[model samples]
Target: MKILKNIILISLFLTVSSCQKWLTVEPEDRSTEDQLFSSVNGFYIALNGIYTDFTNPYSYGAAWTMTTLEILAQRYNVNQEHTSYTLANYGFQEETAKRTMESIWNKAYFQIASANNILEQIEKRREIFTSPVDYALIKGEALALRAMIHFDLVRLFGPMPAQGGDNAAIPYYIENNRKTAPILSLNQVLSKAITDLENAIELLKEDPIISKGPLYSDSQLGGDYQRRYRTLRLNYFATLGLLARVQLYAGNKPSAFQHAATVITQASTWFPFIKTENIMGSSKNPDRIFSTEILFSLQAPQRQQTYLAYFAPDLDGKNILAPLSSRLDQSFENNQNDFRYTPLWASGEASGKNYRVFSKYNNIEDSRLNYNNRIPLIRLSEMYYIAAESAENPNEGLTFLNTIRNARGLVSLSELAPEQWKSEIEKEYIKEFYGEGQLFFFFKRIGKATIPDGKSVNNINMTPSKYIVPLPESETRHRN
Candidate 1:
């Protein structure tokens, strides 16, 4: 992992404002390491810098969170032979498509390496953190960040848990140095990721970010305002929420149900569901569900550029990423009243044609933060889906599922049977997380070979080796 470690550290160091310049830094120099992680303040700067990596052009902030992965899920519409359209059809042979998929592998590992450095330093220089609470919070966040990145990488690069149970998968790099780690089984990868999250939960239970109850708005906060922004950071509930997701991905159904239930019951205190009027409001000042429901969201400084490039409905045919009018109709089960289907969509004219755009992310800026734009990575609604899908009791599952449906202004089902679950859950995931880049994982986890595309039902088969994104050519050039 020598080459991989240097790439993450060098890339991260270069982006830090306090680092002065990217050109003057050496990746493995102990002096650089000591200067960056020597104190609590230094650690804060270093940690914030890692998060900037999370929002870079190729990672969560843009392509992975909003553009490329959504295309992979067969979500967007394609008319002419554009790149994103072909990518929706799994055009791995295309140079840019292949590079985009490869970037998911590379950028994810780079962030993982950044987290590993923090985790390692947390142990070696324990005395530097004089405040025990701060120490624990920092340690917890590093562990959670490491676990979250690895979990996604596994899903992107390997087959689902049931299919790849015993198959060899990606390496779990817990250290930043050039260690000779071999590929582990899929089961092993899930286990390592879950263990880190469980540990993070332990440390974050008393996190100062949410320790005083719900975090304050920017105007109400004092003394290190960064600590007040729990939604943007990996705080207590977000860690628990991730634990539920990781457990579900690993097929620990009962554990997944329990963790999801816990988060929904507790996290509601902070991330309460938006008011009914908010969803029914005017489109000019839309109240986005993501801004309120998110457990963790990556701040997207390049949000406007991302939207205009791929999602804006008024864009020319070559740049538009809208879904077909027919596919949008099917995804919502033809129910126009559902908040996700109607208010969250807009019809805009371009080149004498109308297109259907998902306006779930219509507005990225938070009212409280003048400049911050967050792309939701996880939200409370997903927990309800997890609880519903994983519950052993059929009635309990129906209740969980109905809660979300009802919340979205749809009628609740009087009864639901276990046999009808897979399809229903599929629809809910589609409706709940549109434009949030979760549909790909949802599709992969269910081991679906063929999925519905824009009005092209079940034409995209995703089960071949091609769906499993290849490792970056540079890394597989035999560096490991």
Candidate 2:
């Protein structure tokens, strides 16, 4: 509750004027919430503000996607002097680690508060919306966003579900007030998140993505561009995908498998695998992030800046986030032909040393490419991974795993022992989600005891202290 002092203010300054740039809103004073929510356009702009906040460097734009979480997963070879070295080494109490953790915590809660505020206003001003569809879309997305943010908070700061679902996790703020919400157990938090997603799914049943597909665009949907790009927002499919992820994290394999299978069976066409020409043939401007397959993503205008700061070829060795070449090779099983390997990892010269840097998010010259300036939050491939893990049997799981392997340009596996299924899936995750920040959660979800070291060939031993991020001092200090 005390963290609300530093969190509740939502900046609604931007003006939304065009269909092409509905995400862009005009900036106004923080006290304009009443004015901002007076019209339908205000609600759109307010929701847009929450999406914009996700693009902040302190959150998904950088830390969650390409930097802090990746470092924690040992995806980078950070030196002792590097800014993220302490984070990679699990020094959660160190100053740099503390600041990073606190920033992520505060920023995530800020957006949750923003979404809560929108949810409150939308109910009171439902009459302002001319079309019933608009009301559903706006309210569905607000609920989905709140659920998604809270789920991520639980993943980061809560205990691993396999080990301690009864353990107290983060507070679940449902109201837009300074009064503190009760801190819930890990299972309780996951349950709350699932409840929100289930409600969102019902409300989003009429989501355009369900009927017209994710690419469905119309300039005349009440003259609101928010309906144009459903994929960028939390569309129906993305909500299902997040639910699958949360269910799996909570150790509910049957529910996880069911939801994941739903996304794959019904929504695969909306989010297909990237064409081979996009990555293998086009060297100048490859679709490295596989944008075509992203179920949900954020439009990060400063994605190029993120590339330069961490993964650029010119960054000093001490500062860059490149893994050892041998380690990178081992991650992909030395498979040069793998779509996710050669296209995304490239040799670069930095400080007179050659490094195999992560180029999945590197900026390209062609502005016409849709892949540019986008950071994927969820992809179709992840659904496949989840289905494989939670399938009814190992053979059924192997079939699901092969689906991803073939898409990634690898031959299908014939038969595998039951014990080998998990290791194979782990390998697929390492190859599929590099620089995307899912790898760390994958490791934590399984409660792995050792992980491949980014700096050396050895494995880094893991423990609960390393897997669980401490609650930021800012939040803990204010707790009753």
Candidate 3:
């Protein structure tokens, strides 16, 4: 395996006043009406900073916590038997995980503060961005990002109390230097998220063009391809795709279905799925629905170390004959044509343990770092899945599900009823998006009954509440 590593060392802290720049203005270092937003370069810097914030390990906190949370949650479900992560071994409630959860909560709010600051500055000097189209585009992107961070905070930490939620989620800070607020109920938190997304969708509609410059090229068409790059930019469709996902999670099915359908209809005009052949080996494939098949991936220039801790026993290179062996064996039972089994499974006499390597995330070659593979924040496939699940008609939902499965070379199940079909659809999700962090949401949304981990059959107990993770002790401390 070729491990590609590129280090794009970025300053972690955003001390807005630290840099000396050509543009300087007013009372709070806020730009003037005739200043920053008037020029294209200023807009670029602001947008770049937002992108940087999203990818920062500390700033947004999605990369580390989201991925880890997904792995733990999925394993909790599939390998409930102590044979894998036994109750004796299950320690997500441990002090270490608690601290990590705290960091994630803090990091999310920090990035939101940055996004809010940008929006505030732009609004303060609205005249500089004379064209309403340009103004709305920038504002919309910021709102979308803000909404995303808020939704994550609610999902990971618990509901927010800002808009009157009683569950008391993490504090909602809409203003810069704002004090933390009391927790809100999940419903209230989601309501605010829905509002933000609606506003964002409207704003982004005013501007359709999105690109900084050329990322790569097979041949030079004009002056500098690098300076004319458009392929790497995130446009309106990408933003809407995320909106659909967040809305769906919040239980706004109609809104979710609408946005998702819009994305599906415009997909070819915006982005297409990578051809199966291209996806296998071609690293430069751009058929991904979004700029990177990643709405907000961690922009690590080079991966120095494998994130093996999140890997299943089947995938981890360090663990020999670990607990994941049996799980993989059982997971693939009777499945012959599943492509995931090959790249993600291992079984042979050459090694004592039947280990499977998840090549999906295995970026061994260093050159791949030039393109960030942090963790996909959102993808077109997810939008498609959301559309399927949110479809008002059960039959239509089945069609959407089959379309995606066919693309991945999986069999289509059409005989099942709506209720039965839902369960099967979720199972497909577990198999397809395994390590992609969609598993937990699936369980939560579907309210799947949890099975126990043990040797005795009588020990099994089903509980839906378990799917909603308990708020970390640290988060609770900040609540009251």
Best by TM-score: 2
Residue 20 in candidate 2, Cα distance off native in Å: 5.1
Which candidate do you rate higher for TM-score, 1 or 2? Answer: 2
Residue 98 lDDT, candidate 1, scale 0-100: 71
Off by over 4 Å in 1: 1-31, 209-214, 219-221, 364-372, 455-458
- Model 1, range 1-480, lDDT digits (tens) per residue? 342443234444332121122122333454466777777766665666667778776778866667777777777776446656657666676787778767777777778877877877778889887778778877888899888888888887766765757887778888778774677778899999999999999999777645454454534445555465666678888888899999998889999999999988887777767677766774455566535777887655456667777777777766777788778888888988887777777777544556567666555333334213557888889999999999998888999999989888888886766668998999898888777778888888878877886535546656646467765565567753
- Candidate 3 global TM-score: 0.74
What C-alpha RMSD separates each model from the true structure?
A: 4.2, 2.4, 8.1
TM-score of each: 0.90, 0.95, 0.74
TM-score of 2: 0.95
Clashing pairs in 1: none
lDDT of 3: 0.53
lDDT tens digits, residues 45-134, model 2? 888888888888989999888988899999988768776789989999999899989999988988888888889899988889888988
lDDT of each: 0.73, 0.85, 0.53
